[model samples]
Target: MRGRLRGIRLAVPLLLSAAVVACTTTVPGEPVSQGRVISRDQPGGVDPKSVVENTDGGEIDRLAATVVADLRTYWGERFPETFGKEFTDLGGGYYSVDTADADAPEPPCTDSAVEVEGNAFYCPTADIIAWDRAALLPVLKDRFGEAAVMLVLAHEMGHAVQNRTGAGLSERRADPERFPTILIEAMADCYAGAFIRWVVDGNAEHLQFGHDQLDSALTAVVSFRDPIGTEATDRGAHGDAFDRVSAFLDGYESGVKLCSEMTVDNRTFTLSGFIDAGDAARGGNLEFGQIVESITLSLNTYFAEVAGSGWRQPQVRETEGQPACTPDRQGPVAFCPDGAAVELDVAEELPEIHDEIGDYATGTLITSRYALASLAAAGKPVAGPEAQRAAVCLTGAFTGSLFQREQQFLSPGDMDEAIQVLLHYDYVARDVDGASVETGFDRVTLFRKGFVSGARDC
Candidate 1:
């Protein structure tokens, strides 16, 4: 009953036709290696409060001060090399607002101190950056760690980079076609990714982020995604989680050159919302059983098309717990090549993932097993790095193809769900031997490759 074809009644909202063109950001480098995350405080050379306005010398302010100081140092060195010009520090200076403090002075570029609460941003005209040290930085640090705080300032600093480069500003935004807010936000995110990479590579004088933590850093990145149904071309649209993560990784993997070169024509934007009222009312969600039923059929049909005459459909079954394999154990879901079957834990994890992340997380996990089966049918080994790469890539390829179909089954946040699963879990990248790709960032990269470049790349 789990994998049985139940007449294709899946709920996918919005057309993915917007997801066109292969990703132009093919960075040349080995994936970021996995190891223990190296996070440490900056060596004190100067007081952060001396540089930042309205600073109380709190822990968050110290962290932010060091981060900004490092940002200045990074851009100072890189800007001349990349742009044939010298980098200039913020003219108006940085401002740290204690939003909870009623008597605190107003932050630059904003009228009220409350306006700066729980937010961080670059004020282009004033050439200043401001943040809520009290609320925003604390919460970001609490939830996603210090890297989250670094990511925020780096992104705002990226806006400063754009302002100097003439790529961003209200005057230039008259032509929404070329300068959409989403694209601008993407460029900022890409720049942040590039800076984070510098920190990750042990280049920052004040920061040392482990490559292993890039996954959580990215998790912090997607937390800034624009709310669903926000039009991609809207004046303030920031982009969906998938697009945001893609741009960020483009910078991390490819460097600032790729971030600088981004444009509307070159990037894909799949940020549309529900078209059918019925689906909208239902929140574009199919029940767990319905999701499993519809997605399994969809995956089967999709892979069959890819493999053409050679595709052998893998058996599907729901076990009380994880399915037994001789030695392979792929978390809650396991792909048993010995029996040519995909066994999932109906009793736990998958359902929780669907309930927590969304329907597509489960779909992404299920699709990878079929990817291994397809590899086996094609006489390829399903137990190595190649298999691991192909599994996630194939999963992305299948997800990408949904946009091309007349029958739409992927909703707005579904791609985000896929990303969530890729970043949070390794099951999608698991080989038949139960070994999986090590880094979530790398897993996302491989999955993004198939989605952006299509199945042919896989």
Candidate 2:
């Protein structure tokens, strides 16, 4: 997985800055978007052929047009409610380009349609949003579903909202340190999250969004994550997968108020460059066995010290296949209570994941069982949902601790690796009974709680 493309760079729409004033509103309103409500009734029947210029009115463009209309519904109410201003339509009309067609009209901020190929952007100067109907939207819809298209459009519209609120690109450039690009991008994500939540809450009129769609939304968002090793303070940096997801989740969980309130001082961005050139040369990954040895030792020290009195370290053993636990299958690894051993399959399974997702994926999986053992030692039951969640949380806590290590420390993309694993797998949140958390979102939430607040929060 080191060289494989895990996330697409599709998330980088042109980001200018934004600002806002205060307003008041209430929730508990009827929504018109799809999925939960499953509404197909369009308020005025959005026609991209007329509304968007240079359009073929193809399926992708039609979908994008619907997303734009829904954005109007959500933000028309949201903007005035949150920013104390009446919402206004874009001064510049939306544009759609058939990048595959040489005759397609050029969109704002680009000299030719070729430049906008496989891209979507909000041109701050022109106050317009444009997209490559031929490439970007279709691929997102195909790979991640309609919600991905919805979220991407929402994110681009978020740029317009930023400008409307007076935090336009000019303000961002005026105060780069205070309103860095990362924060701007995060705030935009948060706004998109707010829009998604609005739709999921059944407030949209032209789209459908449900609980199951969140995973697809997240998967799509992460694909747009910043290039590995981007510093949080870099002028053009968006953020790593974890940070980007965190921003989006914050918006989904909270609201525009919370998103608008984000500051460099208040937000936590876990993005940075490699500690050294040698570490970068190695791709910031330790060998499989070496990672297991190092993290196992760190886990023992971390749990022993954190759990304190009555916490006993468990033995680590490797097996060819599954562990010999009496019951319950813990994927490739298990914490055995009968013999007090953390057993794992070392022959094949782990090495593949190690090579596929980086060594830290294996390390994080191993860390969870170690966390389970610590839970058991602390007299906590190890066979329930609470235990499973706690173990995952502690795994995150331990991963966080690796940041400060003098040696065997976390590499630049380690947390992103952890994010990828937790987003795709449930093994980290499995208890001895094999019971697990219900969703990847919940598991990631628990892990994030631990990472942000440390083991104490877990």
Candidate 3:
């Protein structure tokens, strides 16, 4: 796990810097140059081929052009109606020819030679949506069928939509444990569905997916799901098949309102009364203990399936009468061989504690939303509508579980170690009125902004 962690750097695209705006420049004979294109205030270098190919590269290019144009038109009208703001066109930039040989370094615009497998990306850096012709094109033709090619464009364009809206910027410096990569990718998928829905409604003549073709499109989407939930982490944000399809359907069925509702936010939770009561008996805040117990239980269950039966509980014995080791002892003093009691020195233990446990807060956030919503729907007072709204803020933390899992996979350890790491932190909750809600551990801060007013205690 440590080796995996060492290799796992957050592959957040360079374009993820929220401050940088993508620039577009036109090359002579480019399609965007011919269109009613809105140029950026500060133009950056662009690949000429990207623009030229869309205008002149036959059916695929034409199809790509139409998709881009239609999405622009759709959102241009939709944004004003929904948010009372006009949509700004981020200039579509073109790519130049490849200077590298077949085996040499490939140009950004020459997608044909690039490796596309497991790499469906939107290059905000280039201001061009590129598909590795070497990889993705073949998959579209053979496995996903011809229509999928358009869907793929729509999906990539969906990311472009996020960029146009402020959502892309909001998600820029995403804390892996605090934000779920799956949701981000899923939102893009939903945006694609919204675009498709627009096509089905607005321009059926230009673009059409037959019932059978729709099935194929659905299958194409299902192909991207990660079988194991391990991929739920931030670096591996594309969700499992079930979540991917669900998000797409969420947008397809209900449209933008549902999609908007899907954005990540900070949510809060109260410690259960039982857990609080137990803490009262211990004469110390039980919040940390409760968190540890919950995490330990969850990790134990998780590892039991993934690591199998070889997973052993760490032996913790009472240290009251532990014998002092002799100088002749060769092994490190941390381990107690005879008594099986590990004396954890608090000062030393504090620093060695892996802050990774904060990852659990994200997981808890993810799992708790649905749990709270379900509770509210089923008449749980604490999770009722007002509280549910407050609870929704925690979504950012919950979705963050995906990112945490990636970190965990990188530095695999016993479940107890993971729990101990997480238990060191605290959960804070604040009321919607901006007053601190006291929980046993400490006054949990309300991290959410713009919450609805007049909500009762959560």
The window of 10 residues in a row where model 3 has the poorest summed lDDT is 25-34
- Model 1, position 380, has a per-residue lDDT of 78
Q: Scored by Cα lDDT, where does model 1 land? A: 0.74
Encode model 1's per-residue lDDT on 1-458: one tens digit a residue.
11222110000111111211001111111233232222444455336777798899977888888888889999998888878899999998999988898778986566677766667777777788888777777776766677777888888888889888877565355576787777877888899889988988888877788877888677776676655556666655677778888888898889888888888889887666765665566566667778777887778888887777778887888877667663337867777867468888888878888888877788888888888878877777889899999999999999888866665567767777888888878889988777889988899999899988888899
TM-score, candidate number 2: 0.89
Instruction: Give the CA lDDT, 0 to 100, for residue 101 in model 3.
Output: 29
User: On residues 1-458, what C-alpha lDDT tens digit does candidate 3 reach at each position?
Assistant: 11111210011222322332221111111111011111232122122234433223543444445455556677776667655678765454422112122553433433343332323355554555654344344334455465455556666666666665655634555554444555566677676777667665645334544332444455555445442223244454455433454565566667765665565553211111111333224322223224333443443343233223444433322222321321212111122323223222223222223233333332332222232322233343332234433443332233223234533321111221222222222221211122222221111112112111111222
The candidates, ranked best first by TM-score, are: 2, 1, 3
Q: Rate the local accuracy (lDDT) of all candidates.
A: 0.74, 0.75, 0.38
Tens digits of per-residue lDDT, candidate 2, 47-137, equal 7886688888777777788888888888888888899989898888788888888877887667678777666777777888887778777
Candidate 3 global lDDT:
0.38
Worst 10 residues of 2 by lDDT: 20-29
Top candidate (TM-score): 2
TM-score of each: 0.88, 0.89, 0.44
TM-score of 1: 0.88
Candidates 1 and 2 compared: the better one by TM-score is 2
